[model samples]
Target chain A: MGSSETFENELTQLLPRLRRFAFSLSRNGADADDLAQATIERALRSRGQWEPGSRLDSWLYRIMRNLWIDTARARGRKEKHEAPEEEAQFVGEDPRESMDASLELKRAMAAMNRLPDEQREIVALILVEGFGYREVSEMLDLPIGTVSSRLVRGRTALLEMLGGSADG
Target chain B: MVEEEKFFAWLDGELSPDEAARVEAAVAADPELSKMAAEHRSMAAGLRGAFGAVEAQPVPERLQAMLKGDGKVASLTDARSRRQARLAQPFWVQAAALAATLAIGVFAGSQLGGGQGSPIHPRDGKLVAAAGLEQALSTQLASAPANTGPRIGLTYRDTSGAICRTFEDRAASGLACREGGDWRIRSLFQGAEGQAADYRMASGGDPQLMEAVDASIDGEPFDAAQEKAAMERGWR
Candidate 1:
């Protein structure tokens, strides 16, 4: 396959994940789709800069991350996305699990929005995308310890806000 | 606090074996700590719920078109300026650009080749799995029983509670979720090198298979014990 063809084809397979990650970063369905589309454009334009045989997803993610940073900067502040009234809408919550269980997940989602951008990215990449801390550290260009600390804080805040019994 | 970080990192599977052992010991020693660990696991579940569903949602048609629109795809911020520039073009040029874009879409779709059919096919308008594939699905683990038959990798339940497993043979690769008495082939792609499973995808391989699996799993894939137990019951 030609280089551009290979790049676009790979981009299609990554659409689901790239969209999912974007949803986490942007914290809104509409903005997430916009970011994902923008990321695809950026990745294709800069395809030459990506190293051959490296993880294509990482490169796409770095582009998406930088683009989100630029948009955030242009707005002069981070946009909070979780709305208070929509707390009961988690599709994954089991109705029979418990009344508070669904509410806890809702709070967890809101608390995740409350995290710092860096920590939220860490949480999204690790907790949402299921990537490892080291992969996240490299993607964010942060120290491994920084990734862990942010994750720890993110983890604590999410659980505490969920009203888990044993928060520290 | 340091130990707390390790415990959290343990959830991400970032801890070394020894460090994970320490965290496990600490959690076991204190009921509150154990409860906290369980809560952390739920948070990961919650995280998946909050964001991962976007993956299964359809990609917007406009975004798809814009992606295939230009090599630069025209900047999102410059959409209006680009439209103005296009308006300045002769009618013939605009027509040619649209034609070229459609041609590229057709070519890209052909190249994607996601439609390659599997051994599972329709009979009497109902799709049934390959004959021996069901037995293989229950018994095979991700990295064992190296044989000339179809191999299974990373079993997990979907949001609707179907026990889904990935299988790849020479001709086809796909995810199949266990339905009553048969495996329903959920999603499929085909290629020669498609034997590459989700393992390599996570640990650094082409992510096509893993991405497909990710769209299906409700939470973490089954651990070894879980896999064994699920198999023993014949994916019931």
Candidate 2:
């Protein structure tokens, strides 16, 4: 296949993962949808900027994370010193309702909305999306130490917020 | 020797065996260290649940469209109307086959509220198959008596191992799987039948519906013999 065709197919194949990443990044479904769409548009518009040898997911993730930052900035401007925003919404409602319905799951999902922006990204990339710390470090272009530190800190905060003891 | 961060790394499988062994030995020798390890492990377990919330979401239609650009006819909107003229066949005209191919996630969307009563109802904040629709999915067969509400065309197991059936009534159609003794509607939409062959098109046949069928089905949809057998088996 031609390079552009390959890129399109590759990009298409990445939607589900990218959409999940968008869900973890944005505060809610509508915003995530918009962000995912804008990210795709931007990636396609600037297709030349992506180095073919590099990882496509990492590249797409950088675009999505930056777009999310831009969006959060815009939303902050609109809200104008409002309360701290909620974060990390699940895209559609009642996902996995049939299989397992536990209060722990609910608390866990709710806790995801409480992590700080940087920490939440680490949690999503590492704990949620199953990206290894090294991959997440590269994806976010941070030091490996920063990645592990953020994950540890995010977990501590989540445990505290959920009334979970580190000991238990 | 093992710090909290190292414990986190150890639990996440990021540590080399040498470092992991140190962490394990430290925990085995001290209650404080053991508690920390448990806490970190508990936190990791909870985070997995957070991932499930996103993974379980149906692929949004807009996202699906982004994947299939080049002006590919989306499963909804324009495709159904244009295809009806070409796809009209004697069985459809005689039985008044509604051109409803349940778009995977469209019913939950605002687009097909089209007008009047919505077919979906939310229970405990979850959108579920309801009322006449629920009864129809559980009891109706594709070759059931005519005018008997939504017709169930294909019975098969979804990718998730749930038994889901496709049904359409009037202009609305959807796929529903049995869960907790109730049908959990996975996909619902109205407009444009999919490209399934004539036999598969009736109960709620259309390309989008077929796509859903392919995604979820364990094997071929029941033929007359299988459908009859499935009906006899009682959708277990």
Candidate 3:
């Protein structure tokens, strides 16, 4: 197969994991799929930018994070003009309803969603995706110390939200 | 808090060997520290279990096909060129394209009240078609429909072989695909109360909705005969 073909195959293998990370970021299925799709489009269009030997997953994650930031900003601006009542109707819509996870797992996800964006991303990178602190730092372009601090705060907040549900 | 950070760093194995040994010793000797460590570990496990479910789903076929090269990637290139060509067209041509694609009709006053109850409901995070929308997708044909509820647009089989249809009601317009006995909404565009119309306009449709259709559509949208046959087969 050609080099581009090899790249496509490797990207296909990464889809499930890429989608999982997207779900962690977006906290909903529709948005998660959209983000994942956008990421693939970017990765394919700029395939030359990716260093062949470097981690494709890491590159993809960074692209997804940046895309998500852009999407969030756009959504924020759009929401500004909408009536608060219109937005309120969707506030009670639980994203977890779409997942087939256990109650405890759903609760955990809900708590994770409640975390501040910066900390939530760090916590997901460390605890869920299992990236090393330094790796996450580089991916997020923050110092290792800052990543650790955010992870600590995020974990603490998560524990409190879980509220002794897992204590036993 | 500094000490707590050290404990977490140790838990995550981020510390130097000597520091890890020190924290290990401290936790081994202290019950409170050990319990806190256990709680953190369990929480991490719970999160992994929760988020990991997504990895177990069948990757959407559109995503898989995009990697196969001829599907979305080719179309994206086509769309880019088409856009550039469009920019070069005369003003009237550009206006016609916009009007042809966005041909959302002016909804009647009676239809406007259809917003009181949603045609889709979120159940377990998935948008399932409900009430009139569900009935329309299941029974109404693009060729024939009673003048009520949402208007069904194109009926087609997606790349994944699911029966998908487009619908426009007073409140929103989107695509829905039949999956496991329910009409699962794939893409929905909530237009500002009656501004957007039919997405099946032969030319340019809503870009986002068209993107969703582009990703999922396998071949040509079902022609009248094929649609009738698919409907007869219960959209299986």
Candidate 2 lDDT, tens digit per residue, A21-61? 77666654444555676687678768999999788988998
Local error of candidate 3 at residue B180 (angstroms): 45
Please say which candidate is ahead in lDDT: 1 or 3: 3
Off by over 4 Å in 3: A83-105, A164-168, B71-236
User: Whose lDDT is greatest here?
Assistant: 3
Model 2, stretches more than 4 Å misplaced?
Answer: A81-109, A163-168, B72-236
True contacts kept of each: 0.37, 0.34, 0.49
How many Å off is the CA of B148 in candidate 2? Answer: 60
Distance from true location, Cα of B72 in model 3, Å: 4.6
Query: Which is better, 1 or 3, measured by DockQ?
Result: 3
What does the interface RMSD come to for each candidate? 13.1, 13.6, 9.8
DockQ of each: 0.16, 0.19, 0.32
Candidate 2 docking quality: incorrect, acceptable, medium or high: incorrect
lDDT of 1 at B130: 54
Model 2 error, position B94 (Å): 48
Ranking under TM-score, best-scoring first? 3, 2, 1
**Global lDDT of each model?**
0.61, 0.63, 0.69
